[model samples]
Target: MRAFACPHCSSLVHFENSVCLNCGSEISYSRPDRAFVLTSTGRQCANLERAGCNWLVTGDGELCDCCALTRTRPADDDADGLAAFALTEAAKRRLLFQIDDLDLPLAGRREDPVGGLAFDLLSSAHEQVVTGHESGIVTLDLAEGDAGHREQMRVQLAEPYRTLLGHLRHETGHWYWEVLVDRAARNEGFRALFGDERASYADAVERHYSSEPPAGWADAYVSAYATMHPWEDWAETFAHYLHVRDTSQTASAFGISVHGPALESEPEESEKDFDALIETWLPLTAALNAVNRSMGLDDLYPFVLAPAVLDKLRFVHDLVVARPAYVPAG
Candidate 1:
């Protein structure tokens, strides 16, 4: 994610800001353009029904580009109102930023005849009028919004890092491979690295849960669960790609030296090679970890980058920059 500014007053704005803190301007994100644009009549998102959302839909007036992903909303009786919804919406916006930036195809419910991509942000299952839906749709227990609750869940999951952004990035990674990777052209190289994705997913998960992750797993795997199945391996690697790219770009903008083409002053390494990314990222992560230690926090990046992992990163880089085999919208 790159930095965004308040188009109205040029005040720096975060990916999730509904209103600018500096000039009090309203903000809207254009999905098509993959950017946040300002609106004239800025108002709290809570007033959407009465005052309308400042963010325009992809085209105009029909389905605000941001809300187009929604197939269901929380019940009117649900307490938080639009405040919590806005947070979920904002996370989706950031996810879409990656989608548009990489030209990833959207495979929504409309696209799939049966089990397709869909979303539903609702209250928990404790509600009275229960809907018997659960699978393909991502169920974000709205209660997860509480920082304390999220932190506890993070600890419970034994995850190094967990955040709304991280969840969105990881889940979207799953959706991407399901829709993007072409089976016919799935090179032997891909299978060799990630394993045979065609294997039974349920069996793999059962085995993964039953046994402990092998020792020295970090030597090659991006994450522990990534060793379970090829699909997981792909998703884990994909999420890391977003993590590195966004963090590196942000550092570049902020003039925090890590190691890049200009930073190295080495014409050879700076030639937009994968090594350039690593050169900047390694030093930057080291400095970041040191700062975290100063404040008694865990290392920001806890994983090591082995040669095999670098190969995965190179694959992702090529995938992003490669020309797509265009399939006309039907």
Candidate 2:
């Protein structure tokens, strides 16, 4: 995500900041302008009238430009005051910035008929809220914000990587594929590689849950669950694309030097080539890990860049840049 500053105080700001630490200015992300702006609306979000959140937004809501989605308020008595709500909003805006910056296609939630994307920052597993929901609306357990809770979930899932940002990226990938790729032209190729997506989804899920991920899974998939179904394959690849782009951007922005022949070529900033991207990414990741080691920190990027994974990444890039026809949902 691009760096943001408090419009009023000009101090570096976080997406979730309600009051500016430097100047005490209120911050709001405009859903229209796709920008963070100073808000005079006190400390509450304008949408609080409709939804329970009192966090600030840059201007009048014509629709949150960030996600192009809306929420009806949470309960007023929700503890953590507005801080929790603000944190959720900030994270969402950061994710939306990546979405917009990438020009990723969007599909809205099934329950909320709004044309824009949706979000569900659920209170927790113990809250009155139900445990699960579907469609374009992502239901994140608020406990996910806690480091210990997230790590526990990560371990339980046996995932190599997990983070709030990663979850947002992965879930959004599913939504994008639902609209952008699940159409016409691209069916044949996608089917050939990922298997026929026309199969019964419930059956596929049941089968996958029962069966082990394909042997040498990383040779063909980014994550093991991606092997569960074609839809998952697509989502994992999409999330990885975001992962590659955003991390590289961050590296470049920080003026970190990336050496080696792989880093020699510049990736097309407008429309990226996946091949060139990986070439740069591999070297850059090595550099990043080296730096992390210097600081006695864990590897910043923990996964290996296998050729099979690269192929999947290419499929993702092809879909995004080619705007290939979408296949029907399996």
Candidate 3:
């Protein structure tokens, strides 16, 4: 997410900030303006206090656009679940911000019950709650909000990175596949890059857990998990696209135009330049990885985008740019 400044004191604020630290003035995100403003002037979401939501409402609605997408959440009696729900909602808002930036179509369950996006933020305490997307409804296992549990799952799954936002972005990919590719009748183009999605998903998941990914999987797939199925490949690639876009914008917002033998240069709207963004992604991530190494941590971005991966990324980029630019409502 791009950095923000306090509307009251000009102090650097963050996307989730509800109160200005310097001026002590309440602030909230105005979706149409895409900036922080005084809470009194803001179209405050009804969930601002209940869910720790910092976003402003977009229509004449009680809930903000992002919060309205949630169809089900933990009950009030579930204290532990409520805590996790807050963190998950925060991540979901960030995902929606990036989606708007990409100019992708978005609608709440009430807008289109059959295929419009919705979320079920379920707690895994009482029962197993798997994180996946189906029929435009994304289900998240609330345990993912616990740092220790997330770390354990990352290690167990051999994933290089895992975060609440990561889960949100990855699952949103599945939702977009239906909206952007399936509903648009662009499956032929999708198949050329992501393979056929007609394969048995059940069998694919079963086979994936039954053994290791084939050798040389990275040559084509963005991640080892992507080799499991065409659907997974699309999701992983789509999620990676978001990672690159958001991080690239963050770097630009911070004036982070740094690379080996290259630093302190101005970013030229990198997100709009797909080729330039891809070009900068590697070197920028390399510098980030080096910084992490200096701090005795693993690489920030462990995977490499091979030529084939780049091709798939280009396809995603094309699909995103195919949409008209997002213009704030009047």
Candidate 4:
């Protein structure tokens, strides 16, 4: 996440900041200008107070661009669900910010109902809410917003890491799979790297839980979960790629320098080249894990990226950089 400054007082602010601590001026993020602006300059999102949104909007309905992506949200009367909704929306706003920063294509369902993106932020307290992506919509189980519940599921599923942001990133990956690969006419290229996505998805899910990932799976896959199926592999890899990109940018923005051996190139140079970025990322993550260990916390990044995983990451990198050229078919 990039750092922002309060336009009022020139005090350094953050992406999530809504008010200038130094000047006491209300601020909102203007996505179009990619800068902080006073709400007086433009209307704040309708969900600003309800969902804690700090985005500015300009006449495309009351909701800002990010808030507009939400198709289903907890009702006003559902107190617990609404609380969860706030947390999930915050994570999603961060995800969309990263996606926008990366120059990925982002079209709302209204823009192209057939293949455009939308979100259903639902609570699972009363019913089982499966989190996944389908037909351009990402369904999120808002109950995951509870840290205790999220950690419990992480342990139960034997996942090394899990978070609302990670969930949003992974599901959004499926949306991109359509926009950048399938709809963009790059299926052949995708199949070459990730395997045949046409394989039976239901059967793959059944087999994944019934059997252990093959030995030496880490050498090729970023996570054990990636071994489930080609589509999952792509999403997992995509999420991992987002993890690297966003963390690296935040570190750089905050001047959190790592004594990583691969810091020779400028950040822009790394942005243009996959191997170049990894060169910095690998050592940076090592340094991060070292700090975490010193503080007695789990490693910040618990997974390793082998050569095969690097190949998949490079594919995602290329796709993201070229996203402007892809247009969803109506």
Provide the TM-score for each candidate, comma-separated.
0.81, 0.77, 0.93, 0.96
Number of the top-ranking candidate, with lDDT as the measure: 4
For candidate 1, write residues 56-86 as lDDT tens digits. 5544336564465667766666657344555
Clash number for candidate 4: 0
Residue by residue across 22-139, what tens digits does model 2's lDDT show? Answer: 9887676554555567666333454444333324443354444442353432466765523444555556666777765666555444323643357676665447643222555666
Q: How much is 92 displaced in model 3, in angstroms? A: 0.6
Instruction: Please give the lDDT score for candidate 2.
Output: 0.64
Worst 10 residues of 1 by lDDT: 262-271
- Cα error, candidate 3, residue 230 (Å): 0.6
> Worst ten-residue run, lDDT, model 4?
260-269
Off by over 4 Å in 4: 260-267
Off by over 4 Å in 2: 5-14, 17-36, 40-44, 47-63, 66-74, 80-86, 107-116, 124-133, 260-271, 322-330
Off by over 4 Å in 1: 32-36, 41-54, 60-62, 80-84, 110-116, 125-139, 262-272, 323-330
lDDT of 3 by residue, 246-319 (tens): 88778767877765222212333445567777777888899899999999999999998999999999988888
lDDT of each: 0.65, 0.64, 0.85, 0.87
Q: How accurate locally is residue 93 in candidate 2, as Cα lDDT from 0 to 100?
A: 60
> Is 1 or 2 the stronger prediction by lDDT?
1
For every candidate, C-alpha RMSD to the true structure in Å? 4.7, 4.8, 3.4, 1.8
Question: Candidate 1 vs. truth: CA RMSD?
Answer: 4.7
Q: Is candidate 1 or candidate 3 better by TM-score?
A: 3
lDDT of 4 at 135: 76
- In TM-score terms, candidate 2 sits at 0.77
Report the lDDT of model 4 for residue 185. 83
